[model samples]
Target: MTPLLELRGLGVRYKGAVAPALEGVDLDLAAGERLAIIGESGSGKSTLARAVAELLPQTVIQQGTVAWPGLDQKARNGRDIGFVFQDPASSLDPVMPVGDQVAEVAHANLDMDWRAARRLAVELLDRVRLPEPALLAQAYPHQLSGGQKQRVAIAAAIVARPRLLIADEATSALDTIVQAEIMALISALVAEDGMALLFVSHDIALAANLADRVAVFRHGRLVEQAATAELVSQPRTDYSRALLAAHLGLHA
Candidate 1:
């Protein structure tokens, strides 16, 4: 079967930056498959995700193709591709009720009226395991904890039932316990909905735990990619080895 997502010679450079954030990278994610882009800061993993989602800023110069051979039409950002950014505070509207924020996506993408969209929004908040979905629906971004806000963000992302979910460092900002919770939530949702997942993170161990495959990146280039087990057990490149060693050290 055709891959749900394909990238060919993907490159991105901020207009005034000295170097490109991403360069000549190629990757793929199959339907219902979870692929993690592993890289430290400035390594371009986030750039790759944004490129695929076409979420990059207007000033950036992007090259090459992000094609969906598995779908007939080009993907739209909020409709077909759901993105959970690292910071939910910035992604969500502070003034709007969390439910309304989520409902807006469903209302816009699913073409539902506000009342119906709001009902679906509460249902989604419940699905994300938020406590007292009805009450939380009225809460604003500032009212909820970091994890709760992120949960609201997740609810918004999946409200349209998108074909793909790109989680760009979705758990990085949270505490360790909350990180695990969010990871579990993401894993369960992906499995339950069968949406292709593009998980971008610096945490090799987390990537190994959640991804079918992990693609290592460095300095805006793809260093290597392999099955999660294979990559963790026998990394091919020195960089990959170092990354694994670092993760081991952190947990040890």
Candidate 2:
């Protein structure tokens, strides 16, 4: 089977930056596979995620090929990829009704008519388990809880049933309980959609919970990657060990 997403010889350097944010990175994820990219701040995890989603700004210099099954770079420009950012509040439009925002995605990418897209929007809200989907649809972003907003974000992302979900620090802003709930919800949604997931986070334990495999990045370079259990139990590099150690201490 063809890979759901592939990156090769990928490198990124922001204008006037001292070093590349990412350098010569390669990753391939198949359909329904869950992969996590974990590293400390400034480790290029977010850059990698944005690059994969093709959401990077033009100011950054980029070198690489992003390959998706049966689609060239031009053809892969739409709904086949969905990106959920760290903060839904920032990503969402405060002025627009959240429902309309969600529906707009379907309208824009899926070519659904307004009425049909709006109808599907409420269904998506219900799918994400949001309360009173109809009422919530009419509400503004500020009216919803952080978790609810994220769910709306998720709902919007999957409204078109994209093949790959790029979650860039998606659950980082939520409270502990809400964070776990969002993670579980996203995991379930990904599985249900058979969408490959590339989850970017600093939380090793959370990644271990949701990912089949994990990739470790350090200073714009991919240092290690393996099955989650193997990487957690037998980290090869000192940095990987340190990351896992801190994660363990957090739970202990």
Candidate 3:
């Protein structure tokens, strides 16, 4: 079967930066597969996510193709992709009711009517395990906890039911327990919908636990990519080994 998403010779360069944010990056995300991009801060994992989501600014120069299964060309405006940003609070609108926001995504992409969209929003909230979907729907962004906000963000992203979901450092802001819940939620959603997941995070251990495949990034390049067990058990690159060592030390 054709991969749900494919990146070929992908590169991104921002204005005023001498070095490209990403270079010669390549990836294939099959349907229903969970892939994680793991690296340190400024390692370009988020850059790659933004590029795939088409969230990067127009000023940034990009080369190569980010192809989807049905589209003749790379998708723009997130038609075939959905993105959950690292910061949920920043990603959501403070003024709008959470329900309306989710409804808007569904309305825009799925062509759902207002009533149907609102109903779908409530269902989405429930799907993400939010309590009191009706009450939460009326609440503003400030009313929700960090984890709740992230759940809402994920719900909004899933409302469109896009083929690929790009979660960029999605659980980084939540506490460990909440992070685990969010990861489990995402994993469940992926399984239920058979959607491809691109999970970008700096936490190697977490990624190893969550992803089917893990790609290690260093200075804008993918240094290693393999099955999660293989990569964690026997990392081929020195950088990969160091990352695993640091992760082990942190949890020790």
Compute the lDDT for candidate 2.
0.90
Error of 3 at 154 (Å): 0.6
Residue-wise C-alpha lDDT for candidate 3, range 110-228, written one tens digit per residue = 87789999999999999999999988999999989999999999999988677788899999999999999999999999888877889999989889888999999988998999999
Cα RMSD (Å) between model 2 and the true structure?
1.8
- Can you write out model 2's per-residue Cα lDDT over 1-252, one digit (the tens) per residue? 777777899999999999999999998888889999999999999999888877889999999887776455442433888889999999999999999999999999989999999999999999999999989999999999999999999999898788788899999999999999999999999988888899999999999999999999999999999999999888899999889889876221
Kindly give the number of clashing pairs for every candidate: 0, 0, 0
Evaluated with lDDT, which candidate comes out highest? Answer: 1
**Could you tell me every candidate's TM-score relative to the true structure?**
0.97, 0.96, 0.95
Which 10-residue span in candidate 2 carries the lowest summed lDDT? 69-78
lDDT of 3 at 243: 88
Ranking by lDDT: 1, 2, 3
Superposed model 2: Cα runs more than 4 Å off: 70-78, 250-252
Relative to the unseen true structure, what is the C-alpha lDDT of residue 113 in candidate 3, on a scale of 0 to 100?
88
lDDT of each: 0.93, 0.90, 0.89
